[model samples]
Target: MPVFNQYYYEPLETKDVLRLVALDPATDERDPLSCTIFQCRRSAQRQEYSAISNTWDEQTPSQTLEIRCDDDISYVRITANVDALLRDFRAREKPCYLWVDAICLDQTNGEEKSQQIPLMGRIYGEAKDVRIWLGPDDRVTAKVFTLLRLLSQVLDVQPQWHMAERVVFHLNEVFCRKDGVVGLKSLLNFFSRSWFSRRWVVQEAMLAREAIVHCGRYSIALLSISLAATRFLSLDVASYPVNMAASLREPTTKRGILELLWYFHEAECRDPKDRIAALLGLVPNEKRFPLDYTAHWTELYRQVASLAFGLNDRAINFQLLRVSAPCPIQEMPSIRRGSLTGQSLGNGPYLSFLTYETQTPTSGILPHLNGGNIRFSPLTEASHGSIGIPQSAGNGVTESPT
Candidate 1:
């Protein structure tokens, strides 16, 4: 019946990730082995595919075109359709990674679409480059070009620089309940919770350090509070041994480095506008901190527990997460009671993120856990003097839910 809310160029899901993505391979591969976002070329050019006929009944070309806000497509005009968009991508032979929604996601396969939405980060995250398709308006595409160029300027690099290493390639923001204040904060809150989420904080910090040297500090307490929370509520020492120990002590090692990341996110993203600046490489003019965002969206989160189960077909409804604020910008996306449609990414991601952005590891980077100092030793000798878990899983720990 109705067109659902969709991201223009979202990534593929872990399970539906029909291909393995990588940079130019060693072999003579014409196309890398990864999912693509494709569409009908001719149908796009003509601007109409007779849905009622169920055939390629095309329409004569007209000067003006209509672009539907939602899938409703009820008489909105001024741009191209999905087909024309893909044609452009093919023509451009875009040097960097490109992710077109139609070609990337299986629209005909409704079963998979639902599972793919929440993993939006993986789709774009896994991409080395991204291309957005602005409908038929020359003005629209031109603005998109300008936006990309400006984004690049902020990200300023030499011409020889590779944007593929970083950048999500945003094309448009038309679908917001209102693309102004509501849109800005909705986007801010969305990226903030995710870009440096609690579970993968340690891995994210480690990745940041490895990629760019040191990353950032915080404004409101993020990591320290996270460690405290996880430590107090941790149920399994066997599965979360590193977290259990790190929660009790001050964070120093990579094992519990996540605590530090939460701090960094809060400091950088405290203001809704500042948060975007941090992501877009816009200089942080915040009074409390001054850290230029050095790296791109580094997705290092892993919920081992999610791997312990299968995906729910219901994660596609991330739209329900969008709240239509008072048609404004200064505030964040608030949870509107009875506003959205359903649940999102279904409270699990380790498997989901991997599903979309999965590139088989070729680097073989060593795991950072150090056994004696940060690693777990047999509890007997170490616990001789003070409080200890009585050998049989009684020390407030249980088998990993994972």
Candidate 2:
């Protein structure tokens, strides 16, 4: 066993590499939940485990505190939302293994926190399933669950019914009635919940092979949520629809880091450092940036921007120019930083620019040319370069190599 900085950790072979909790809600609602940290070796042979994706309860002051669990001496610091999530997913018939971030990782130790951030991709991707906790359910939550169920049914049988037109009609019918206003409001509330906007959950849910959203006593498939989001994108709303669409869209195709940051930057997280760390795992291996908790936020933004420029592809690097937000740090430029206010919450900057094909630039001329040739002159005499230069307008031009 060894320690890095203040964080104490053992080698994978020697220590229990995988830490989980076995949660059992007490029979009496008045009684507190029974939670014990179960340590196990991360080997080829392992038991089924589920990872919990959630938002920390930061707004509620009293919700953030150390509480006593069934485990002995040390009181674990957890939020009220986490406690509720644990109790909701408690298994009565058998023990369930869950990898919850707040408890599993050593929050007090910065080094350990750094180590765990990278492994998050694997943690969620390898889990039997990721359970997304969207806080407690109310009247709104119940309607949302019902809406998803109905939407799922419609989407499933959509092909046979028509070219998704029938599905669209039903969607409008469901959300446009007298009580539909309240239902739509409730549905909006469901999507606007902190869980959907969480940075960690964005990556966790995206990487998961399978996932489900747990709302109090009710639960629904992640697919249903995504389908419902797509349906809502058809509606003309102020901002929620666009935010919901971008938030729920699966990151199946490889995309630049800028897109990921802009899409979920509004999401909640305790650490400003996590703005980068939480989403780093979802980026492609080649484009992936380093996870350094020691660096300042401005430095981190600069590093990411510099990496984008080094790629040398205009299509990718040009996105840096598309940034529409005001920079928070005076040291960093607006192009390198995005606003956290959800100001540009539509189909992402990159997607907006890359939507269609553009004519290649020969001499920086375009569609108005009708059909013309362009040529580049060789280096000037002062540059000590000898080359042949050709110029043509209606036809192609040929140039000799230096």
Candidate 3:
């Protein structure tokens, strides 16, 4: 057996340059997968290619895929998830031009990875459209797509139906039918895929000018899926799937890092630091915390805490404490320590202020000093509004301080 050469990446000439892969069309299903990598200037003005957003399935076996870097043939090991996606592309009639992180960036080069990480938002946004691979289709894939198409049509007729109770009731009635029930179940199964929960997809989906979701051969516009999810929420169904899709439709620039972190707390990433890093794209001031893969998780967490506290927004600061308290990083102390003080905590006045606030909750602080309260009212009540309640005895149904 002849040994195939291992592929090597030539250093990217400039910070603005990145690699794109041109997949070679395969004549037969059994033909070996092959692609050619070439450098290109990364900019939104160049819309010659699509970017791929996919979950890297580490549990699956890796396959050796061929690459043509220049005049030499080389091979790289890829996860099954990527292998399946490339194979799907190979089956297409024409070659696809794609910006796939695994293939385009030199994973072995830490410097290259770091440089490419910050450009991810632009890379996805600049692409003509983002292609989301949800792995091979299951039995319910067709049903899920069919139902999403129907929901999209309904959304087109009336885009603002989510807030209307009558329309929500009608949608519930329609989807509760036998066939619709089956379809809804299929939709649930579809969202249960790993792709939806991956931390990075949040940014990829939000930044894309257009996005197409692929499950094996079946492909649908991501907007259709997102609209269907919105309809799902108007019916008062569980918001697991809706939470994943609905936010993608919103402008990424409006949300802050703290809010993004809270919203996507459950989203998983391979690297612990990526819990914060993945969200950089959606945040307005991404430069506030630059991407540094080499930094320790504790260092990153402290940097995030400092940024949140530095904002001087009381609501955001309190919310940050709530979000960071349960974080798995043990080196950082919680409010119970009287102060979030330590080498990792850094020396900031906000820490001392937070410490004082934590201990003085029972000292007759007003409702505004705390993070406000949620008021309960009967379903028949006409006017539902929030009222401030002082921290005094005999206050009717006041929320306890966190």
TM-score for all predictions? 0.22, 0.69, 0.73
Poorest 10 consecutive residues of model 2 by lDDT?
Answer: 383-392
- Once superposed on the true structure, which residue ranges of model 2 sit more than 4 Å away at CA? 1-16, 41-43, 59-73, 155-179, 238-249, 313-316, 319-402
Clashing pairs in 3: none
TM-score of 3: 0.73
lDDT for predicted candidate 1 compared with the true structure? 0.26
> What does candidate 3's lDDT look like per residue over 339-394, in tens digits?
11121123432332222222123323333245533221111111111011122222
Whole-model lDDT per candidate: 0.26, 0.57, 0.65
**Which residue segments of model 1 deviate by more than 4 Å?**
1-16, 19-80, 92-99, 137-402
Better of 1 and 3 by lDDT: 3
| Alpha-carbon RMSD to native, per candidate | 23.1, 12.4, 11.3
lDDT of 3: 0.65
lDDT of 1 by residue, 1-402 (tens): 123323243343344343221111213223322222223222123212111000111323222212233343322111234334323333223232233333344445444544443333333333332232212332233333333233333342334224322222222333223224432333233223322322222222321211111111111122332332232222121123233223423333332112232223323222222222222211111211222222221211222112111222222123112221222222322111110012112332211222121112223221111111111112222222111122222233331211
